[model samples]
Target chain A: MEELSKKELVLKQAKLAINFGVGVIAFASIWVFQFTIFPDFFKPEPTIVEFIPDSTEPESVSYFELDSADIENGIHVPTGLIVDDGCQDVMVTCGACHSLDLVTQNRATRDGWKEIIVWMQETQKLWDLGEKEVVILDYLAKNYAPENTGRRKNIENIEWYNL
Target chain B: MSKKDSRRTFLSKSAIATLAAIVGSKVVFAENFPKELEPVGLQPDEVKVKIPGKSDQLKILNSKPLSAETPPHLLDDEVTPAHLMFVRNNGIPPEEVDVQKWTLTIDGESVVKPMTFGIKELMDNFDHYSYNLTIECGGNGRAEFNPPAKGNQWGLGGVACTKWTGVRLKDVLNKVGIKDDAVYIGYYGADTHLSGDPDKVVISRGVPIKKALEDETLIAWAMNDQAIPVMNGYPLRLVCGGWPASTSGKWLTRISVRDKEHDGPKMEGQSYRVPKFPVPPGTKVPDDQMKIIESMPVKSIITYPKTGAIIPKGGSFEVRGHAWAGDLKVKKMEISIDFGVTWKTCELKDPINRLAWQRWKINVKLPEFGYYEIWARATDEKGVAQPMVLPGWNPKGYLNNASHRIGVRQG
Candidate 1:
C-alpha cells in the first residue's frame, strides 16, 4: 500500500529496539548480579542502639586512649590493676567480680592479702570493704607478692615406651 | 517549592526520623534487657551457639568463673552429654537450691554415729548405685603446658564420661561409723566464694580414707539420668570413682573424718599437688616433695578429623578416638600417622563403664596428602603410656598425658 505502511512502521521500530535492548541487558544483568554476587543483599542493616536513660542523655565518661605500649607493659591498665596508688580502689572494688586477671594471677601476703579480702568478704558476695579494706590490702600486698618461681620443669631425655 | 528542593526534603525527613529513633531504641533495648544488667567485665567473642543437647562445639572458657571446653571433636560421645558436660566452677554457682532443705552432715573425728541425711533422707535410706564414671580435670592437658599452666587452660575438654547416680560412699560410710583413726575424707562444698566469701572454702577436697571407702565411691545425686546440672553438682555431689575430679566434691555439704591428710581448702600448699619426682619444668619442690594428685594418666584424644581437618586427596579416612585410664583398663590404642615414625593399632571400643572411656577406631590410608599428624597413644592396664612431651611441669599444671595431636589437611 504505501510501501507496506512504511514497512510496518519500520518493523515496529525494530521490535521496539530489540525489546528495549533486552530490557537494558536484563536490567544490567540483575544489577551486575546484585553488586557482584549477592553482596550480602546490599548490606547496611545493623542499627539497634537503645538504652537511653540517665535522665535521657547525661552520662558521658567514655575515655579509652590508653595503649602507651599498654600503659608501659602493665598492659592497658584499665583494670589489670597496676596504675599504682591503689589502682582506683582496685578499679572500683576488685574490678567488680573476677578478672584483674584474678588479681594479677595470684601471689599474696599482707596476711595473704588480708586472707583474700577476708575470703572475699566472708564467701564471695564481697561487699563491705569498708575503709577500702586497707587500700585494697595495700595494693594486694604491694603489687602481688609471692615469688619463688620454681617447680615445673620435668619431662627430660625421652625414650621410655612400654605400652 | 524549590528552596533547594524544600531543603533537600527536610534533610531527608530528619534523617529518617533519626534512623527510626535509633533503630527503635535498639529493638526496645534488646527486648526488655536483663542479661544481669550488662556491665560486668564484658568479655564476649567466643560464640559457637547451638546448645540443644549441646555439641555446638563448646569452648566457652569463663562465663563468670564457670569454664567450658568440649571441642576434641565434640567429645565423641559415650555418655558425657548433659549438654556436652564440662563446666568447672570454683565458686558462684548456687542461687536457689532448697532440695528439701539439702543437708548431708556426717561429722568429723571419723564419725561413729554422727549422721544427718535429708534430701529425702539421703534418697530414701541409700542403696542406689549407678556408675560409668571418668571425671578428670587434674588440669586435664593444661593447655599443653610448655611454659604455660597455672590453671584452667584445659584442652581435650577436660574430661567427661557420665552416668553417676549415687548412694554408696561406702554405704554412707558404713551407716556413719568409720572412726578407726580415719586418715582423711574431708569434702565440704556449697559453692559461693568468688569473693562473696562465706568464710572462704571454695575447694575443700579430700579422699584417701581408703579412697573414701571405695565400692566405686559415689554419693552423687544423678548426672546422666539428669538432676545433676545446676552447673553440675546440684543438691549433692561426690562420685570420686577414678579419682582426681578434685576428689569429687562439688556442692556436697560436709563429711570430715580425718586423722592426717585432709588439709582441706584444696588441701594445703601446691593445691592438688604433683611432682613427687621429675622436677625441672620450673623446680621448687619441697612440700614433702609434693604428691597428692590422685589418679588420671594414660590419656588419648583425636576425636575424629578435627585439628585442622580438610581431607579428600587420596581417600580412606576413619581415625576416631577417646581412650582414658586412671583406675586402669585402656590396654592399648596407638595410631600415629608418620610423626612417631609409624605406628597403628587402634580398634578398641569396649568400656561402657567400669570406670568409663575407651572408644578408639582407625583405618587412615591417605598416602599422598600433605599435612597429616593424627597421633593418639593411650596404653594403661598399668603399662602406663602417653607422654610424648608435656609430662612434668607441675606448679599446678598437673598430669598432662600428651600424645593426642590430630592436624589433617590433604589438598
Candidate 2:
C-alpha cells in the first residue's frame, strides 16, 4: 500500500470534497426538476384547426385559363398556335389529356414529333392514330418544329443603365 | 430592324423617370418593350381557387399536373408542417380514396408468394414505427442552371423533414418472401395519368433492393400522427427517406420486386437520372449513359432571417438551419461570410434517427457588414462537402446540392 504524505493527503481530501459536492448538487437538481417540471397528469387537449373556404369570391384568372377561351373560339391570338384546320385535330387529340404548354414548350423536328407520338402510343395509351397522325404531325412539325435545339441563352454580361 | 426602334429603351428615359430612379430606387429595366398584354397581374393561384390545406405562400409552378414549392423561410419549423410540404405531382391524385378498401399488392419476379394486404391488415400485423425523415426533389435547384433546363424551375424549397408513421417495408417484404435474385423494388401509385387513360400509370419508380430494406424506408399511412393530406398521397405512401421524393411513390398501390432494374415510367429515359459523368451545362447526354439518382447529396438550407434580411446594428445574430445527407450522417455544418474564403464551424446536432435531417446553429459574428451573403455548407460523414458553386449540370437539371446563401445588410 502506498502511504500518502501530509501534503498529498490534504490535496486528495479537497478533490473528494469537490466530487461529493458536485454529485450532491446534480442529484438535488434532478430531484427538484422531476417533481416540479416534468409532471405527467392533467395535460391539455390538442386543438385541431378546421379549414373554411370563402364561398363568395370570384374566380381569379390563370395564365393557362386566360387564353384558353380565345383559342377555343377560333379567334387566333397572334402569340398562340397557328389557327388552321389541323389545329383543331391537335387540340382535341393532344390537348385532351395534358396542357398545351407541354406542346408549346418544345421545339422539336418532324421526326421528333413523330417519335413523341410513338412513345405516347406505346406507353401513354394513345389509340392508334392511323392516318390522322399525318395531319397532326404536319401541324406540330410546321409550327412547333426546332428553331433551336438547346436551352435559353445565358446572359453573360449586363449593361448598366444611367440614372 | 429599324435604327430608332433598335436603339429605344423599354421605359421612357424622361426627366421624371431619371429623377425618380436617382431619388430613391436603384432598380432599372432593360431596353426591350414587351408587346403582349401581360396576363392578369395577380400572382399564380391568386385569382384561382386556393388549394385546400396548403400554405398561401407555397409557390405554384404548374397547375394541370399541379406542382408547388415551399419558400425556405416557411420551412424553418423543425418538423415541416403538413400544409407547408411542397407538392410535386406527376399526375392527379386519385379522387375518392377509401382507406378501408385500400390494398397494397406485393408481387413480381422476386416474390415467393404474391400477397395482398389491406390497410387495416398492414396496420394490425406489423410493428408500427415513426421516424423523422427528409425527402428532397431530385431537381431542387434547377432554376440556377445556366442555359436553363426545361422542367419545374424549383429553387431551394423543394424539400421537407417530416415525422412519418408506418410499418417497415422490410417486414412486409419478408412476409412476401423475397427471392435471392431480387435486384430492385418498384411501386405503382393510383394517380391518374394526365391522359386520363385508366390503363396507363402516371409514374412507377423504385429503388435498389438494399435501399428498400433499410429501417427508415416505410410503407407510411400517417404523417405527423394524422392522415396525410390528400394532395400528398393521403391513404398510403411509400416513404423512402434520403432518396429523391419521386422514388417514394405517392398513393402507393402496388409493390413489385424485380430480378432486374424495374422498367417503369420515369425510371428510365432521363426522367430522374443524371449523366454518368459530369457534363457541362446544357450538354445533352445520351439516354443509355445516364444513371438514376440514388441517395441525395449532402445539402443544407438556412431557413432563418429570410433572404434580403436587414441585420440589426449589433452585427450579431444567431443563424440556424437544417442539414441532411442522404443515407448518411452530417459530419459538420459550416457558414461562410466571405463566400468560401473562410468558414466558421456551427454546433451540429445528431439526428434523432437514421435518415433524419440534423439541426445546426451558430452565433454569427460578422466582421464588418455592408452587404454579406451568409452561405451554409454541410459535409457528410464521408467527407463530401457541398460544392460552393453550381455543380456539374446535366440536361434534366437534377441533384444540384450547392451551398445555399442569403443576402443580409448590416452596418
Q: Please give, for every candidate in the order listed, the TM-score of chain B alone compared with the true chain B.
A: 0.33, 0.88
What is the TM-score of chain A, computed separately for every candidate? 0.26, 0.46
Q: Which ten residues in a row have the lowest lDDT in candidate 2 chain B?
A: B27-36
Candidate 2 residue runs with Cα over 4 Å from true position: A1-96, A99-163, B1-49
Please give the TM-score for the first chain of candidate 1: 0.26
lDDT by residue (B79-189, candidate 2, tens digit) is: 999999999888767766778888999999999989999999999999999999999999898877665555677888999999999999999999989999999999998
**DockQ (C-alpha) of model 1?**
0.06
Highest-scoring model, lDDT: 2
Clash count for candidate 1 is 22
As a whole number from 0 to 100, the lDDT of residue B28 in candidate 1 is 24
State, as a TM-score between 0 and 1, how close model 1 is to the true structure.
Answer: 0.31
Q: What is the interface RMSD of each candidate, in Å?
A: 15.1, 19.8
